[model samples]
Target chain A: MRTIRVELGERSYPIHIGSGLLKNIGAYCQEAGFALRSPLLVVSDSTVAPLYLPQVEEALRSQGYQVVTHIFPAGEASKSLAVYEDVMTTAIQGGLDRHSAILALGGGVVGDLAGYVAATYMRGIGFMQIPTTILAHDSSVGGKVAVNHPLAKNMIGAFYQPAMVVYDLDTLLTLPPRQVSSGLAEAIKHGLITDEVFAYWCREHAEELLALDLEALGYALELGCSIKAKVVGNDERENGLRAVLNLGHTIGHAIEAVGGYGVFLHGEAIAIGMAGSALLAAKLGRDRAIYEETVSMLTALSLPIRLPEQYSEDDLMEAMKHDKKFKEGKMTFIIPEAIGSVSIVNDIDEQLVREVLAQLKKEDNPW
Target chain B: MRTIRVELGERSYPIHIGSGLLKNIGAYCQEAGFALRSPLLVVSDSTVAPLYLPQVEEALRSQGYQVVTHIFPAGEASKSLAVYEDVMTTAIQGGLDRHSAILALGGGVVGDLAGYVAATYMRGIGFMQIPTTILAHDSSVGGKVAVNHPLAKNMIGAFYQPAMVVYDLDTLLTLPPRQVSSGLAEAIKHGLITDEVFAYWCREHAEELLALDLEALGYALELGCSIKAKVVGNDERENGLRAVLNLGHTIGHAIEAVGGYGVFLHGEAIAIGMAGSALLAAKLGRDRAIYEETVSMLTALSLPIRLPEQYSEDDLMEAMKHDKKFKEGKMTFIIPEAIGSVSIVNDIDEQLVREVLAQLKKEDNPW
Candidate 1:
């Protein structure tokens, strides 16, 4: 197992990436000195529970944890306040306590939902992320847990760190192809923001990574988590540098929310968001070469660069305008300056934003 | 004005307690380095909004702030998840940004609900508590913000600190008689959990406090806030020393929740909860005199020592069992060891708990 410590003092936890680690999470918890005062409350969803919950339960049970599992129907819709209430109501029924730890044993949605439940329950509780999908590689490490509002995404949440993240690679081997591609978008984002060599490696091994070759996948996931850990460690509350992590999230969230949610995977939305950011940067006199490179990279990876046809420029603009990153009608976009470098640019002209969003759609009929 | 600094390291903020501080909030924020990043989004409820929102808004406006106001229907019902959603949605609509701070301007409900909104909005932004009620002296200072769940009270929340607290005592003059009694319960709690002299002072001045004698009320509120600030500074997350603050909360929350909510004020419930804890502590061979002192103090303040007639022992126990503080079926009770000190005892005999609840109701019919 390759262990990456997140380096958040006292709140620090490890991201353990390896095959077959799911069966040994009990050992990891013990090492973390969880001294768990109550039985484990394993929170998963219908989609993941059928595939992974049994083994996870067995392993935890073997460790003498009298586990209680609460499963909800899986999807982004499950992140709503109604479901959040259901999860908490069920968690309480499952006999969770202040000292009890909640094991979030699913992908991004489950992690966000369950992590939020752990975050707010009893003011907060111990939480561990047992990520079953690659998207969690990014979400699991940041300590950002939230539930979606009907009008916006992640409108309610907290910056609560987990005690550990058990990234069992064996679970990823079962992730559907679409799920894999959806998750790859964020890993690519990590490389684009901070590491040129890693960015180039991602470009060169695009096919290998897409095909889920174990070696490429492991390195990509580990590297993505390491980058996130460092960023979160330095800026736990995202008052400064952590804002860079939301590089494409502004317009991306707008698009995802505009698409009525669950239509585009989180990373898929992130992928398009990164593209919009790049083009906006280019329009604002950022290196044009970097813009083209980012576009080409996203296109090559089969990530959508064009705005979803269903959304109008006005629709996307309205959504983007509501993004939490937007301040007083001025927008902030993190755009790539070079292969791996990015800058947080604010007050991009509204007409320019409208024009760039339109340009994204114009390229839909490429030669 | 007396300034008490809640010493929570870099996240620390000042609690300004005095009469007429409400109209000077703008000056306080500017001096505190708020810089008015965005227009103020002042969150209030129907009752407090009509009573105090205009003055609060006028003060903020004078500070060169563009204010946006959203008022929901008042009372404890407003702290539901449904209302929590409306607050967040309205906040986004009100043009709140990451830099903008939410001004919570009401009693504990407004502080808890609005503080929670600020805590989770954009993964948290700047927040200030403008408590208009004496009960908020406890809720506002601790950084413990939350909304209630159907199964429990304050079941969904966070331990998010505020930028500053503007506790204007003048607002207390217009409060209803019952409101005064409700708010004093927390001030009494602060004393029962820490300083004997404070407890004695509370008893000695009970009539003046209930009568809203400005001088007496000011001392009670300041002392209550000072005690909370110290406990929270020493332990922000209630991990160790902070847990003592919940001394009567376990059964108290149960009583409040079981009483179908809205029936008893938070402070009223806390008063009964404190009495229960004292009796339970006495049952464990602590000083019996402490129990007499607590009951008499609560009675003098017009706080209920009797359990509400509507809830049966089974109902209260069931509610207590679901408390976040309970561990492995053993409830955590903050038993008063003396008038000034309390101990956190877990797994007290269930029979003793039954007798205590029964004992509380016995005094309902005095000879």
Candidate 2:
């Protein structure tokens, strides 16, 4: 078992990663200082619940902790206020107290939604992130829990940290190939943003990671979580330094929004955005090698580096304008200076972004 | 103007109280360091909007702030998730950026609804409290912002502090006599729990406060805000010391719920709960003068000290069971030790609370 602590002072908590940890969830809860007297609410999505909910409940109940379960349909659409309200209703009906904790038992969507439920329920309660998917390696580590609004993704949320994060790697054995690639995109992002060696390591071990090699996958997740935890700990509210973590997010969110959040997974969209950022860096007269290397890394993991031809540049630009990163009619892009390094550049030219989008949409590789 | 600062380390902010302060709101915004580049959203209810929103918008506009206004229907019913979502829609549609500020421009309902919006919008933006009612003196300063759920009041909310609180004494002139009494309930509560002298002063100057004498009201509000700010500063998340701020909230919230939150205003219900707390303290072997003095103070301000006969004791107890303060099937009551001191007592006998309720509902004065 490997444990990484997110150093947020009083709000600090640990992320425990290992095999078959779900069966010992009760012991984890006890070690994490969760009281048995208070009832616990386990929020899961339909896909993850059928597989793991019974084991989680049995473990908690065996430890004399009252357990209540709330399962919503599995998808990005479930990350809405209406679904958040449903989970809140279950929490209220379940008689969960202020001390009671809400455990997220699925992937990124479930983690985001349940973390948000904990953030606002009774003006913030105890929350534990139990990430089941590889993509959640990014979402669950940071305290940025939110439900998407009709107008935009993650428009409504809070920076409420969790009590702990229990990552049971055994759950990842069930993920399909597409989801696995999607999840690894963020793991690769961690390396692309700060760790040069890890970036090359991820690309080198792409097959092992994709083939569900436990040792390789475990090492990647731990490194990714550590990089994310360091960034989040320094700037919890994204005042300045934290913006670097959004290297691909500015353009990435736009891609996700333009694709209606369904056509592409969040990690897939971000992978393309990272590719776009590298291209944008080259357009701004940075080294062209940045673009080549980013695309190479993403492609090695079977992640797409091109936008679907159907999405128009104008629509993508419109979506970027609605993003939280867009300010005063100016786009803020986390432009890559080189591999494992980035700089936050404000007021990037719209025409340059459009040019990059056009190039990305080409049927052939621009490189 | 009188300023009392809530010392919350980096989150600390000032409460500005005086006559005609709204006319100079633009100056306050500038002094508090609100940026002119980002647009500002003002959230008001129909009633307060008609009275002050125009002047506020004009003031902000004069200071080069691009202002947008969102007004919902007036009253407690407006503080629901639906209205909260409506305000969020208006905020998004208004093109509010991360740096933009949200000004809560009404009483507690508007402040709570708007503050919750700010707390969650783009993972929180800048928020300022512009209070237009005497009741807001209590609500605005403490940063306890929330909207009610169908199942409960303040069930969904956050302890998000505002940039500053602007209390314009002129707005209090428009309040009706019943509102004057309702608002004073909290002011008297602040004094009762912390300062014996202030509590007696509130009783002594009841007529001046009700008559809208700006001098007396100003002094009273400053004192009340200071008391609250001190308590809130010491304990921001209600881990321990802050629970005393709920002097009458346990019983007060129960009464409000049983009455469907419409029959009595929040302060009025709390007034009766204060009376009930005094009775409970007496039953627990405290001085009988505590009950008499409390009833005398409430009556002096035209606040009710008795629950209406329509509410059954059983119904009130059931409501208490659902309160956030109720834990492990035990009631946590802020019991008065004397006229100006209180203590948080947990696991109080339910039957004893029932007796207090029965006594409070009687036609005759139990004291």
Candidate 3:
């Protein structure tokens, strides 16, 4: 098993990446100072619970853990306050204690919502992540768990770290093809911000990865998680260099909000967002080829490059104002200086944004 | 103004304590980089809204802030998830943004509930505290903001820090006698844990304080807030040393929980809780005299030493299980080692708690 430590001092935890990691989660909890006999709360969604919840529960129970599972419907809708209330009530009824760690066994939706529940439940309980989809490889390790508010996505959440995140590669075998491509958006972000070699690797292995090449996929997952762990350790609250991780997220979140949260997958929205940001970068005097290259790479992965129907430039601008990055009533965008470089720019001209949005709007094709 | 910094690195904020400080809040926000022209969302309760919200709004408006006020019914009952939802929706309608700072202008109930709203609104927005009651002297300083769940108090909340805390002593002049005494419980606790001089002062001015003696009360308020500031700075997440501040709160919370939250003022419940903890300490052979002294001092201040006749010891124990301090189903107690000394003791004997409860059962004539 390969391990990457997210160094957040007392809040720090490890992400174990490999096959068979799920079967040994109880031992990890034991080593993390949790009681082996303590009850484990397995939190998941309707989509993933049926496939992995039983195996995760069995894995813990085999090592003497008394497991109780709670499943919510999968989608952005499940990240509401009502759902948070229900999940918390269930946790209390199941007799979860500090020693009774929460095992989040699902994709990004379940990971974000359940991680938030664990963070606030009893002022936080121990939690371990058994990421089932490729999308979770980034989210599970970063500790940025949140539920979406009506006006915004991830508008209600905390920067809470998990005790351990077990990213079992074997679990990804069951992830849908579209989900894998969606996740590549984040992996692409890590490459664009810090690692050029990883960017080239992604460029080379796009097809192999889409074909479910296990070794290539495992390397990509570990690399993404390791980079995330380092960034989170250095800047957990995303104040400084950590904001670099939000390369495409600013415009991406606006897309998600404008389209309404559940209309597009998180990574799918980000794919188009990256395109918009890249276009903005080219307009701001960054290399034109880098923008074209980014679009081509995303398109080759079969990720959507078109903005959603019914979303206008004005709607995107309005949605961007709601972003946490907005300060002094002006939206900030993270634009690339080049393919392997980016910066958080707050002084971008609004007219420039309008021009880029106008270009994105005038595209002939929807996808 | 005397400033106390609750230093949690980047999340650190100033606690400005002095008389007439509310008038300068606009200046402080501007200097802190927040635009004073943005609409201010003032969240308070009905009891405090009529009393202080006008002055607060007047001060902000005079400085060109577009102030919008929201008032919920004043009481512990208002600290529900329903109330929080209402506040969030109102904030959305009022155009509150990441730039807009929420001024929580009331006692503990307002501070806890509003702070939780600020913590989750748009995934966290900047908020300030204009504590109008003595009980707020404690709630406003620590970043531990939360609302009570049906089965538990503070079960649903997060450790969200504020931009600044404005403790204007003039606001405390209109505070009721019961609120004054409630605030004193924490003042007494600070003395018990770290400041012996404050403890002695509590004993000396018990009568004056109960009568709202401004000089004595202000001194006590400053001392308590300063001590809490020091502890919170050192342990933002309550990992170790910060638990000292919760002296008597573990059992005090249980008592309040069993009594249905609003029946007993928080300070009244804590006063009795201190008596119970002192008795427990005496039984444990740490400092019997200190326990007796605390009980005597509480009696002198006219604080209740008995739990409400309705709640049985079993009900208190059941409520204690929901406390955040419960690790693996075992409730931990913050017991005194001696006067001016405290420690978290996990191995408290249940029979001893029953004995303490039995003492409350006795219908006594006079001390």
Candidate 4:
């Protein structure tokens, strides 16, 4: 087992990476100072619920925790205000209190929604994250929990920290090939904006990581989480360095909304958005080679490397404008100056961005 | 103008109390460090928007702020999830950004809803409070922002602080008599849990305070705010010391939910809950005299001294059980040991609570 700590002063917590960690939740819970806290609310969604809920429930039960499990429908669509309210209602109904903590045991949707519930329930409560996807390897560690607004993805949310994140590699075995690909896309972004060496390594081991080679995927998540930890630790609110972590997310989020949520998976959308960001960077960034490398690596991983035909350049640009991160008429993009380094540029030329979108669409070999 | 600083480390903010302060929002904004942030979003409800919106917008416009104003309907009904979503959707439409700050310009409903939107929007942006009611003098200062869930009031919310709280006593002039009484009920609560002298002063000057006596209401708000500041400063979350501030709010929140929201005003319902707390304290508390005085003071102020006829003892008890504050069938009640001091007792006797409810209903002269 390897432990990586994401530091944010008093809000700091650790991310545990290992196999069969879910079966040993008792030890982890005790180490996280959740000794004898009963009636643990284990929250998951429909897809994840059937796969790993019973194992998690029985594991906690062996530790003598009266676990209350709740399963909402699984999907990005579940990250809505109505669903958020329903989760809180579930917390109240389950008799959760300040002392009784929440254990979110699923992917990003469960982690984000449940962490948010912990953040605001009875003002706040302690929560443990058992992230079930490669996507949550990024989402769960950072404690950026929020629900999506219809007009914008993740428009309403908070920078709430969790007590600990238990990334049980055992759960990864059950994920579909597409889910693995989607999660790895975010892991690739983590490497691009922070570590050039890690980015190249992800390209080198793309097949091994995608095939869920236990050691290779574990190393990728660790590298990804470490870079994110430093970014989150320095700027939890995305004020400065933290914005770099959102490299491909600006266009990524827009297309996802344009794609009507579930049509394009979060990771797939972000992968396409990264392609546009690289194109924007190719024109404005210092290192054209880094931009070329990013495009090549994404293509190698079988991730979408261009905007889909359904979305017009005009529509994608409009979707980007709706992001709150865009100030006035200017949208800030995390321009890759080098493989491991990035630049936050606010004076993004609109004509140049439109041109990049046009060129990205012209590409015939994105997949 | 008197500015009372509510100290909570870096989250500290000022509560500006005076007459006609709303007219000079630019100066207040500068003081709160929002001098040049533009495209200010001024949020309000229908009742307050009609009365004060133009003036506030004009004031910001004079200071060179490109102000955009949004308003919802004026009742407690507007504090629903639907309305909260609508407010965020409005922010998207208005193009609010990280650099842009939200200026909440109304009573508790507006303050709570707008502050919540600001708290969650883009993972938080700066927000100012332009409280326009006597009730707001209490709500705005504490930085507790949330919307109501149908199953529970304030069940889904966050303990987010405001950049500045501008309390213009001039706005209180427009409030109806019931609103004045409703606001004072909270002021009286602040005094009871923290300061005996302030509580006694409330008893002595109930009529003057209710009539919106300029100096009296000003002093009342300042004192109430100071007590709240100290409480909130010490405990940002309602863990231990902070729960005392919710002296009457346990049963208080229940009866409000039982009364179908609009039936009994928040403070009016809290008054009834306070009466129940006092009766419970008379039997279980050491300071019997304090309990008697509280009942008399509430009755003197034209606040409800009994639970409404629609809710039975069983119904009220069931409602109380729903409170997460109560752990393991044991409800924690903030019982006043005297006017100036209170203790958090968790092992609340259920039979005694029932008997007190019975006695409260027996009192005929509630008004």
Candidate 5:
């Protein structure tokens, strides 16, 4: 078992990573200071709920903890205000008190939705992240819980830290190949942003991670969470330094919105956006090797490096304008300085971005 | 102008209380570091919009701050998630960025809804409170922003502070007599919980306050804000001491809920609850003078001391049970120790609460 603490002062909590942690969830709750007298709410999605809800409930109940479970449809569409309201209704009906805690027991979508419920329910309550998918390795740790707006993603949310995050690696054994690749995109992003050795390590061990090798996967998740925890701890509110974490998110969010949030997973969209950022970096006369290396890393993990040809550059640009990162008709991009470091470059030219989009659409891989 | 600072470390902000502060709002925004380049959002209600929105817009525009205004129908009914979503849409449509500021330009409902919008929009933005009602004197300061759920009031919300609170005494001149009494209910609540002298002064100058004497009103508001700021500063999240601020809110909220939130102004219901708290104190073997003094204080300001005959004790109890303050099938009451101090009493007998309700319904007030 490996534990990484997100040092957020009084709001700080730990991320526990290991095998069979699901069976020991009750003990973790006890260790985390959750009250047994208060009813605990377990929020999961349909896909993950059917497979693991019973075990989580049994574990919690065995410790004399009363449990209430709410399961929503499993998809990014579930990350909407409507689903949030439904979950909140279930919480109110379940008679959960301030002392009661909410445990999010699925992937990124479940984690984001449930964390948001905890953020606003009774003006914030105790929240624990139990990430089941590899994509959640990034989202569950940062305290950026939100439900997407109709016009944009994560438009309505809060920076609410969780009490703890319980990551049971055993759950990842069930993920399909596409999901595995999507999740690893974010893990690889962590390596690309701040850890040079780890970035190369990820590309080197791509097969092991995709094969659900618990030792390799666990190490990657821990490193990814640690990188995220450090960035979040230093700048919880994203005043300046925290914007570095949004390296690929500016264009990444635009891709998700243009694709209607269904065609591509969040990590997949971000993977392409990271590729775009590298391309943008080269366009701005940075090291050309940055673009080659980023694409190489993403491709090794079987992550998508190109925007689908069907997604027009104009639509993507329109979507970018609606993003939270777009300010005063100017785009903010987190461009890679090298493989392991990035810089937040604001006021990037629109034409340059369009040129990169055009380059990404070519039939043959072009450098 | 008298300014009282709510000392919340980095989130600390000033409460500016004086006559005609609205015209100087642009300057306050500048002082508070609001950016001219980022568009500002002024959220008002139908009632307050026509009265003051133009002036606020002109004031901001004159200072080179681009302004976007959103007005919802004025009432407690507007504090719903649906309205919150609408405001968020306007925020997104208006191109409100992270640097943009949301100025709440009405009473508690507007402050709460707008503050909640600012709290969650793009995962939180800058917020300012421009209070137009006396009741807002209490609501705007403590940063307890929320939108109500169908099941309960303020069930969904966050503890988000504003950059500054601008209280213009001039706006109160337009308030109807009933609204005046309603607003004073909260101002007087601030006095009742902490300051014996201020509580007595509220009764002594009830005529001037109701008549809208700027001098008396400013002094009263400054004192009330100071008392509230001191309490909220010590405990921001209501971990302990901040619960004292809910001295009259528990029963007050129940009364408001039972009355369907439309029947009684929040302050009026809270006035009765304050009287009830005093009566409960006497029933708990405290000083009988506490009950007499409470009734005298409320009556002096034309505030209701008794629950209407139309309301059933059973319905009120049911409403109380749904209150956020009610925990684990136990009623938590903030019982008055004297005229100016209170204690958080948990696990109070339900029967005693019923007895007080029954006594409150009597034609002749009984201690």
Candidate 6:
């Protein structure tokens, strides 16, 4: 097993990536000083429960853990305050203590919502991520877990790190083609923020990744997680450097909120948001060729590179206003200075954003 | 004005204690680079709302802030999850944002619950405290704000700090007698941990403090806040040294929980818990004399230095199991090692705790 540390000082923890890692949880729990008697709650989504929950439960039991499972709905709609309350009720009835640790086993939604539950339950508790989707490659490492508020997507959440993230590549074989494309947007985002070299790799190996070529997929997950771990370790609270990790997320979340979540996968929304941010960056004179190349690569992977027809520019803009990252009523956008380089911009013109929406709409680009 | 810093790096904020500090909020906001927008929400309880809300609202208005006020039924009952929901609803209706700060202008309950509301509303917004009761001098400064759960007091809360705390001394002149004595338990606790000089002051001036002598009260507030600030600055998350601040709070919380919260004022229950801890410390031979002296001083203040008659040892022990500070089912208690030193311990014998309780009950020294 390879260990990548999401360095958050005392809050720092490891992300373990490899096949069959769940069977070896003894060492991970030992390292975390987990109490032997405290029961473990495994939270998974409906899609993941039938596929991986049994094996995870057995592995934990073999390690002398008393395990219980909680299954949430399988999509973005599950990321709500009501579901958070449900999960908390389960935890309370199960008699969880500070010693109790949560194991989140699913895609980005499960990891995000469960991580948030662990963060606020009893002030905070220990949690681990057993990511079951390719998209979790990004969500597992950043410690940015959240639930969607109706007013804004991910408006209610916290920066809670997991005790360990067990990313077994074996689970990706079951991911839908749409989910695979969504995961690639985040991989592409990792490259957009701090690794132009990785961006080049995705550009060259986009087809191989889609085909689930084991070696290529493993490299992508490791690289994405490594970059995120480094960024989150340095700035756990997203004050400055961590915000760079949100390169596509600002507009991406707006798309998800405006389009109504689950319409397009998280990665897909980010893919389009990245395209929008690129257009905004080009208009602001940051870089034009980088924008074109980024969009070309995402489009090549069958990801949506533009907004859907029904979502108006005004609706998207309104959604952006409710984003947690909004500072002083002005929507702050994280745009790339160049491929592998990102910066936060607050002075972008609103009319330019509207014009880009018109251009994307006139071309009938996928939402 | 006396200033104490809660040293949490970027989350760090100051507590300013003096008369008329509320009148200079604009200056403090400007100095701190707070994005000035209004109206501000002044969250208070029934008791403090009538006593100090008008003056505080006028002060903010004089500084060019459009002030709005929210009041809840006073006491520990106001600190439920339901109250938190009410506060959030008010904030949503009032159009609160990162720029609009919450002024928690009451005792510990208001400061804690309102601070929690600020921490979660729109993710998080800035908050200030204008503490009215004598007990608030400690609560207002340390950033240890929270609401109680049905199972445990302070079971549901966060360690969210305020932007600034304006502890106007003049407000204490009208405080009720029980409130004045209740706040002293914390001041006494500060003396037990890293401040022998202050502890001796409490021992010498218990009567003066009860009488609300201005000089004694000023000294108590400043010294208590200073000790709290130092401990918080060193360990903001209560991972280590900060737990020292929880001296007597373990059983103190148990008393409140077992008695259903309102049976004893927070400080009164803590006074009993302090005696329990003192007995345990004496048995362990860890500064036996100091423990006796501490208990005597608390006794002189007319505080309840023994458990309530209605609560059996089993009830207290069972309640202790659910304390927010418990880990792995082992009860951890903070005990005084000397007049000016404290320790967080999970290694104490349970049988010894029972014996200590029996002895205290039979003696009926105070309560």
Error of 4 at B215 (Å): 1.0
Better of 2 and 3 by DockQ: 2
lDDT score for residue B202 of model 6: 90
- In order, the interface RMSDs are 1.5, 0.8, 2.3, 1.9, 0.9, 2.8
Clashes of 5: 0
Q: DockQ for each candidate?
A: 0.74, 0.80, 0.53, 0.66, 0.79, 0.36
Q: Residue A86 CA error for candidate 5 (Å)?
A: 1.1
Q: How many angstroms is residue A330 displaced in model 5 relative to the true structure, after the best TM-score fit?
A: 2.0
**lDDT string, candidate 3, A1-367, tens digits:** 7888888887778888888787787787776666764577888999988877777777778878788889999888898889888888888877787667787888888888888888888667777777888888888887889887688778778878888888878888887888889988888778878887888789889998888788998999889998888888998877688888888887789888988886878888888888888888888888888777887778777788777557888888887766777665666788888777888898788788767766765566212
Instruction: Go through the candidates in order and give the clash count of each.
Output: 0, 0, 1, 1, 0, 2
- Fnat per model, in the order given? 0.84, 0.69, 0.56, 0.73, 0.70, 0.38
Clashing pairs in 6: A307-A367, A308-A367
**Shift of residue A164 alpha carbon in model 6, Å:** 3.0
- Model 2 accuracy (lDDT, Cα): 0.91
User: How would you encode candidate 3's per-residue C-alpha lDDT over B160-267 as one tens digit per residue?
Assistant: 888888888888888777777788887887888887777888999888887777788778888888889899988887878998887878778888788778777888
Give the Å error, residue B314, model 3: 2.5
lDDT winner between candidates 4 and 5:
5
What local lDDT score does residue B195 receive in model 1, on the 0 to 100 scale?
Answer: 91
Q: How far is candidate 1 from the true structure (C-alpha RMSD, Å)?
A: 2.1
Lowest summed lDDT window (length 10), candidate 2 chain B:
B358-367
The model with the greater TM-score, 1 or 6, is: 1
Look at candidate 2 and give me any clashing residue pairs.
Answer: none
Report how far off residue A111 is in candidate 2 (Å).
0.9
Tens-place lDDT digits, model 6, residues B1-367: 7788778888888888887765676566556555556347889999888977777777667777766678999989889767876777676556566567788988899999899877777556678877877777778776776776666677655667888887888888887788788899888888888889888889799898999888888889989988888888888777788888888888888888888887888888888888888888888887668657877889877787866566788988777767766666666778888888888888677788777767667554422
TM-score of each: 0.96, 0.99, 0.92, 0.96, 0.99, 0.89
**Cα lDDT tens digits for candidate 2, B33-95:** 888888899999989999999899999998889998999999999998888888888888888
Q: Which structure is stronger by TM-score: 4 or 6?
A: 4
